[model samples]
Target: MVGYARGVSRVLVSAVLVAAALLLAGCGSDAPPVSRPSSLPIPDGFTRVGGLSNGLVMAIPSSWRSVDLSKTDFEKELEASGLTGATLEQAKTSLRSLQKSKALYAMDPASQQESPDGFVTNLNGFCQPSVGASADALIEIAKQQLTSVNAKVSEAASVPLGQGTAVRIRYTLPLGKALINGTQYYVPSDKGRTCVVTLSTDLTGKNALFDQIGGTIRPV
Candidate 1:
């Protein structure tokens, strides 16, 4: 299970969002009326996005332009992560396997002004070592890699996502004079896999797309 966490470790990328607050700010476009179940109402301008190779799909604000990370250092980072052919292929497979309402957007370390909230949020999937693993273990894995000062964890419990349940991880960090909060709702996926949806924002709590976004995850 720990090994899985290591591979799914980009959860740490979120730390970049919270940690930066020690320095300074708080943190999209258009598209279709992607029909959803009555229970899951997608807000206006929330466009469907996903990886072409991976079946991963999800709805993001249509106002937020599609960020193509493939051309960015993202690929280099993945390569440098020490993932070999088989492991890399498996990782790709797990993500592409997602059917609907799963998305990953590009996070630009350099440009923060382009995004509405001065933050980048994303959705993704990973192959896990154990499908039945506990939420605490996964959270701990991310926490160990995070260098947060006076971090406090809350709402660490199972919550419904789409047709399945996810471990909702909410935590706060004090960076410089700023208060940063991050949330990750993790779901175990098919054939020992995990899916993660993350939100990173300042104490202002300005983003409102997540609640509508959460409902689009189709039950596996």
Candidate 2:
């Protein structure tokens, strides 16, 4: 299971949105949409986005972009975690294994396990680093940074990975004095060193986004 949190406080939503959009567009797409899902209301300029390895699918408002985790500093941290015999390629392999398994665990941190107003679920897969440091350490650093963004932990749980544990944490993002939802997953390598998959994202609506994304996530 993954932890989730929500809060209501003014933050640079526009900036965050821009950053997210830029990240999502890491791989450019020029083809126009052939069709839109009739069941779902596609926001203006919304584009289809999917997790690179997990095949997790979601639609981001054109204003929002998909970020490639591999290019971020987080990737470097995963590599630095010092997982024994763990390499970027091997870590990706492990991530696919987790996705296929769909392991269950809590998403909220241990300190904030009582609140349950938002959505949470364990994303099936491990995270792989393309380059950089240990993934697990990067995630820890991310957690600390998010706390400054007025985010709070909703749940936290651990799942078994090759030689490490997958840690899931749900954090609440506060914007305009309103609680915005988000979840993050950190899958460390077998040696419990670096994270294979370190994923986090905002819960668009009651985790509707998560459900949409999760549906598309498949093991690479």
Candidate 3:
């Protein structure tokens, strides 16, 4: 999954969020909540966000702001994160590349404001044709790609996500003096596509929180 590698690279570099493409148009506005089984463990106070057309949905912290990647004006948010000049421009470029692929991105405002070097803690998701590859193989590919970038693969296993289980890979990448901790979930979906959900953060020991949020992914 070259797309998965590219997605991971973008997150490591630009600090963007992830999920399936065609997420609801209005970034911060509440979309109609998808009906979910009560047994599913969604975090308290989290908000349900998804795209109506694609029927893919995930829950994010209510405090996190969803960014409409297709929209141009996130300059205020970037500026608020203390980004300026080339770094800011590179980030915008990375985001726009995701936008071109119709991906969904979001970020935690507090993390963004507190980061030492403007690497915003974030999540992003997008769907790509699986072409008959098994979920395990896809995740292994991601693991390899991450390892190539000097990211330490801490864990790799199957976990409940969406309609079935997903292969979850947790890793930490050291960039300069900062450690970026993240998890990527690979869920095989209907119609021969795989849905990828990723979460990256500057804080450490967030596996529980990350899994809790990733577990909420579902295709409507």
Candidate 4:
């Protein structure tokens, strides 16, 4: 089960970076200029994140805090997120991974308060070069990758996102005795890359909130 978790993590992290077969797409600092304060409709109880030269705009729950590893004080960020000790180390590792991939990351402040070693509900996004693969094809590749790792894939389809459409996938994977629920979106961008957004959590009932957040993703 630990292996399965590692596999799933590899698949998701790869999606944040290289994404097997598909070329990597950069975001964050390299993103195109977006309107000040964002022009997209902010969901109720959610705050819009990403801007300035970043290539995407997204909304996360108001209770969640977006992470900017480059500028954020790691130790302080973890404390504010209610993490400490080994959990802080784990989160620090995750944040470094996201930072290295140039991805945008966010998490619920109390996500790790209860289960110290459990998966934290979080959202992250990055981009991969389309390389001619359509959204449907990209999603299939993602599906195959997860299934290869024995992850249970429960959903895959193209869904509306912002002004365009994206391929969305929902899956569950075992981690020790727990199950991790995850949702991913492959959004084609005008910037010649496919933005891959992911929402992952241990909580099973956050899909509605995940959908609400994913709906706000738009290539800037």
Candidate 5:
């Protein structure tokens, strides 16, 4: 039930990032993919954002704002990214005080999405896993947490994403009279970083924006 989970995605993600940031991904330096075979055109209405400098890239509608780490922590992140070669546990604890943040690259109110209405989407990046965590392990962890409350989890599977692998976790959360469906694409890059792309709507299935954005991801 971990990935099947809804409201808790933010918390789990933030905690995970802060819990293991320094060890897994050391202030990721910007680098561009040398190939784009898995790449697809950016959706017609969406604009591509981010560049090699940020260490990742994606496409989304133009309305969203790129969230920034709290200004106070700016220098802190810079400092953490510089050090290397620590024991696994030390790197994990080092992230305890860190702030885990995500960016909302697209949000459009004008668009029409009902059912479990959804309007915003986010992209997240996590670096190498010293534990050598795989896509299956990621899916398994999410399922355990989400199943505790009897969340409906189905179509749990892993697919190759570029040179890496991605776990697709689909689930529904009961909200009184309505049920919210969510689709999460968690990809661990060939380089060892992880990218999580998610979409949740009160509606029944996938949204165009969601599908479109998924097309542009090269993953590795």
Candidate 6:
């Protein structure tokens, strides 16, 4: 179980960073622009990075560096989680594993589901709890932490994840006094587990990046 917990944590953190990287990559700071080849798919001003598959879709800026779970250090952390018997390849596969046995609960706007008062609000009821409890619990914790750090909720929408058994919270963290924006996705795995992705950026001048990359998100 400890190994599972660690594995989930790594997945959550990595996912959030990946999402953030995409968002950041799209944003721009107060600096002169550098020339690039016109053949690139990303617009001249905006950076594009990160994407999703398996019934999920998202795109972020190209400036941020996506965390690579295949790195040896990351693998070591997964192994330290008491999952010595589990190979690094297995850990990576498990991060995105989807379960088909569950379904997301009906969206009940009146179901006491407040826009998380802070970042770390509970997501237990987002989907059926048949998946691992640790995954769900960690999501709640991450939300609270993120909320604390950003102090404002830009957006929050619920969407289906895999099949119908899981759900996700897609939102953005408003730019703070530092002019940084954070975009996040809190997704529950098909087994009713949770995975999170976040992107932080300085969108001072390049607001169009959000417009271009924002449309890539869709419910599974």
Which scores higher on TM-score, 5 or 6? 5
User: Please, what are the lDDT tens digits per residue for candidate 3 over residues 1-220?
Assistant: 2122224444333332221111110000112222343434557889876563333568888987765553456455545544456655655656665665455666676665566655667777766554554445555666777777777888887665544566688887766556778787765554445566778776766677787888887643
CA lDDT for candidate 4: 0.60
Candidates in order, TM-scores: namely 0.55, 0.33, 0.72, 0.77, 0.56, 0.34
Clashes of 2: 59
- For model 5, residues 115-166, the per-residue Cα lDDT tens digits are 2332222333322222344445556677775565455777567654443345
lDDT of 6 by residue, 142-189 (tens): 566556545454444443322222222334454322233444444443
Compose the digit string of candidate 1's lDDT tens values, residues 91-187: 3333332323234542223223434444333334322233354556666666654444456776566555554456666776655554556666565
- Poorest stretch of ten by lDDT in candidate 3: 21-30
TM-score of 2: 0.33
After superposition, the stretches of candidate 3 with alpha carbons farther than 4 Å from their true spots are: 1-42, 53-55, 70-88
lDDT of 2 by residue, 67-94 (tens): 3333323334334433224233343333
Clashes of each: 16, 59, 9, 5, 13, 24
Error of 4 at 106 (Å): 1.0
In terms of TM-score, which candidate is stronger, 4 or 5? 4
Please, what's the RMSD in Å of model 3? Answer: 8.2
The numbered model that scores best in lDDT is: 4
The per-residue C-alpha lDDT of model 6 at residue 109 equals 20
lDDT (C-alpha, whole model) for all candidates: 0.44, 0.33, 0.58, 0.60, 0.43, 0.31
Q: What C-alpha lDDT, on a 0 to 100 scale, does residue 215 get in candidate 1?
A: 52
Error of 3 at 210 (Å): 1.0
